[model samples]
Target: MYQCEHGGVVRLKLAVDPDLGPLAAELSSLARGAGLDAVGITGAEPFGSTRRHLEQRKAAGLHGGMHFTYGDPARSTDPDRALPGARALVVGARSYRRAAPAPPRGNGVYGQVARYSWSDHYGPLRDGLGVVARHLEANGWQARVLVDDNAMVDREAAHRAGLGWYGKNTALLLPGKGSWFVLGSVVTDAPLPPTTASAAGGCGSCARCLPACPTGALVEPGVLDARRCLAWLLQAPGTFPIDLRPALGGRIYGCDDCQEVCPPNRTEDRRHPPPPAGDEDEPWVELVRLLERTDAELLAHLGRWYIPRRQPRYLRRNALVALGNVGDGGDGRVVRALVDGLAAGDPLLRAHAVWAAARLGRGDLVAGLAASETDPEVRTELAAAGLTG
Candidate 1:
């Protein structure tokens, strides 16, 4: 006997036969019905190759202090670590693609947000996976859901499940579907058969994503150096790299240049136009407004994002960089934000503020602080900007 709940209604189906094919099919259907765009199953064998890649990358400093999967490659690559006796993985991908909204018309400079972070897509993805997990558990099988979590290497699981191939950008590109999806899985003890047919194609000869990378983070096919990735740098702690700050452009969080240029992604968008962004989607943020917010206000607005050590200052740090690149120095509001940032008590903020002011041709604004600035890091920025004689 198997039982599952959908839309607050309990449904039961008899599984008289010992075969698990029917169960797997039903779970896939449930996942799709629950809003997942794709679903596939794969064995729970450890991702040994992936573990080696992570270890090698971390050793080479390609991870750029990223601690997610790199923090514990062994633990992250092994599904059994997530759920003991795990025999299969039911992977799901929820599409995050949507028609980008027109840039908000406002008085302040706007910072671009990566498509994935525009909304809480992961929350819905988890709910969809939960539906499948609950079904498995109701049938007396142990099931655990992992989404955007370090417990499992989701892309590897998705690839093995025949969901997609690895793109040069290191994203799982679904056949005809592109890479604009968030992936997750339900690690379970069930002995479901894996998807036999692999995603029909590979990224052969098309290396558009490589040069498309603003910072050359995609050093080679299917490899990314996080140290130079604008997406990672925005979330990274400390000062944004001085050399890469100009390329940072107006992005306050995440970078999509690679996928934006991928042939498959572009084609997908043409064939199946995505729906308009929802009201809740935040594709752009006002830089001056964001800088003006109080600590509590900033956190309340963007707390869902992965702020380094959960500090609000990092958010301001990013905004300051974006302001430097896009903010109009002539705009009084922009100057006010830079002024606030330069005057901030935290040296980290003050240092980035100095860079922003100088980049916007407002070096005069930093002159006043040069005499009084004592922090070594801020002093370095001042000297680099030539604000200090």
Candidate 2:
């Protein structure tokens, strides 16, 4: 017997019967019918190799202070930690792929958003997994849905379920389907038969994604130095690194350079074109407007995103860096945004704004402010830009 999170005890039973295979098939169908693009089952064994990899990488500092799966590899890799007496995992993937929207033509400089974040893809993925979990519960099995949660390593679970192989970019690539899907799992005590095989193909000799990384974050196949990854950097706390700011281009959140160059992803796009994005998709954000938003407004707009400590200033800091890369110095609105950033109380924002001002050739705006700047970090930025001696 195992205790569930809701304070209920469930007797653990191995459903070792002829019906296990058919049950797995039925669950798969249920998952697909509920909107999952891909679904498979695997045992709820601890991901031993994945735990070792996480530990080794974390020890070597490849995790770059990231504390997701790396934070507690043992607990994350073991499905039992999520649900005691867990016997199987029903993994599901939902495709978030969509045609890129045309770049908006506007007065304000726009910041590029990564594809996965164009909308809340995880919500749909979770909804699909919830369907499977509900079915298990209705069958007198204890099931818990895990999506984008640190309690489980969903990718390894997907791979173990024969969903896909790990791409050199570290994304799980499904056969003929590419890596444009978000993954989730339903951990349950039901003894379901595992998938018979893994994804049919592997990355083979292709290494295109390694060099395609804007910041060389891949380091090598299947390994990422999160310190240099733009996606992780955007979500990391404190100031964005100075050296990586330029390569950041106009990206305010996440980066897709690696996946954008993957041959399989490109092939998938050409073969089965995704539907064009609708007006609801936010592929771009106006930098000036983002900078101008109040703390409440900013949080309301991007509350779903993983902002460090849920602070809105990180958004502004990212916007300032993007503005520096793409904003026209001659534009009054651009200048006004930078001025507001430079004068803002947050030293982090002021520093990034200083860099943006200098990048836009508007050092005159920062020269006067640097003399009275109290923050050492802001002064350092002014000094680096030659705005101060």
What are the per-residue Cα lDDT tens digits for candidate 2 across 170-274?
Answer: 999999989989999999988888886663879999999999998999998999999999999999999899999999999989898898899999999999999
TM-score of every prediction relative to native: 0.95, 0.95
Q: What's the lDDT for all of these models? A: 0.91, 0.90
Mark the 10 consecutive residues where model 2 has the least summed lDDT. 10-19
Please write out the lDDT profile of model 1 over residues 1-389, one tens digit for every residue: 24445534332232122478889999999999999999999989899999999999999999999988888999999999999878889999999999988888867699999999998999999999999999999987889999999889999999999999999899999998999999999998887877775748799999999988989899999889999999999989888899999999999899999999999988999999998999899999998899999999988999888899999999999999999999999999999999998999999999999999999999989877998998999999999999985
TM-score of 2: 0.95
Off by over 4 Å in 1: 1-18
Candidate 1 vs. true structure, TM-score: 0.95
Cα shift from native, residue 384, model 2 (Å): 1.4
